[model samples]
Target: MEALEAPPSLAPDNRSVIFTLSIHGREAECSVLREALEQHFWVQPGAGDARILKAFADGRKRITAVAERKLRAHSDEQIVLTSADFEVRT
Candidate 1:
């Protein structure tokens, strides 16, 4: 994200942080795992984005599994990810 912020020329299309996981293992475990990853990123200085977008899910659990996130909106979200945003894509 700092790399993005460093350049005034190409303002990133929001915070383009993408999280992808193929949870053939325990879906529940991996869902939380993904959250931890997101939090890890959020701990950065300018890691806070205005919006969070999760675009993958596990049908059985109805929880987020993967995220193609862009968090540069106005309204802010703390940690707004569910397990329904992920699916087995591999």
Candidate 2:
């Protein structure tokens, strides 16, 4: 029998988005896209089970643009958004 293990954790300061990806045309292109996103988002520093893009310093649109540039297909992936704070606009 296998022993139970504890689930990984996230930092209290962390905020990010999760994306599912797919690479078409060439398999090698996938790494290129991943590298681009890492350069763009800087990925979350330190260890965790989560695969997420670090929040953009500028705002939400910048993050969306990054996703727009990287996402090649409309049907193959998912992006989950989270807000650090909840706000009501008039």
Candidate 3:
């Protein structure tokens, strides 16, 4: 995340703020999510992958929570979530 300041040549009152957000590499995780989506929804493959990828791109908190839950369930041995973990029972 970065913010750029207005140039000095610009009038103070007319100045506008600029913000830039950059997301670093997560290729492996994205691949895993893609595979999971393909396996879970064969009829609509790649559909849910976009939503999950967008969640990652937007830095949603739910993704972190899911990871934390997975870690806790594994007693810190590993962090992993299978298709079942993503299913809603109800």
- How do all the candidates rank in terms of TM-score, highest first? 3, 2, 1
RMSD of candidates 1 onward, in order: 15.0, 13.4, 15.1
Q: Report backbone clashes per prediction.
A: 16, 0, 0
Task: Give the Å shift of residue 71 in candidate 1.
Answer: 3.0
Model 3 Cα lDDT, one tens digit per residue, 1-90: 111122112113312111121223211121124343344434144344345444343433443445445544554243444456566788
Candidate 2 TM-score, true structure as reference: 0.24
1-90 per-residue lDDT for model 1 (tens digits):
211111111115543333322223211112223343244333333433432223222121233212213122311332234323333356
lDDT-based ranking, best first?
3, 2, 1
TM-score against truth, every candidate: 0.19, 0.24, 0.38
Q: Give the TM-score of candidate 1.
A: 0.19
Best by TM-score: 3
Candidate 3 regions exceeding 4 Å error are 1-32, 37-55
Best of the two (2, 3) by lDDT: 3
Candidate with top lDDT is 3
Q: Compared with the true structure, what per-residue lDDT tens digits does model 2 show for residues 16-58? A: 3333222343221111122233444454445243454323323
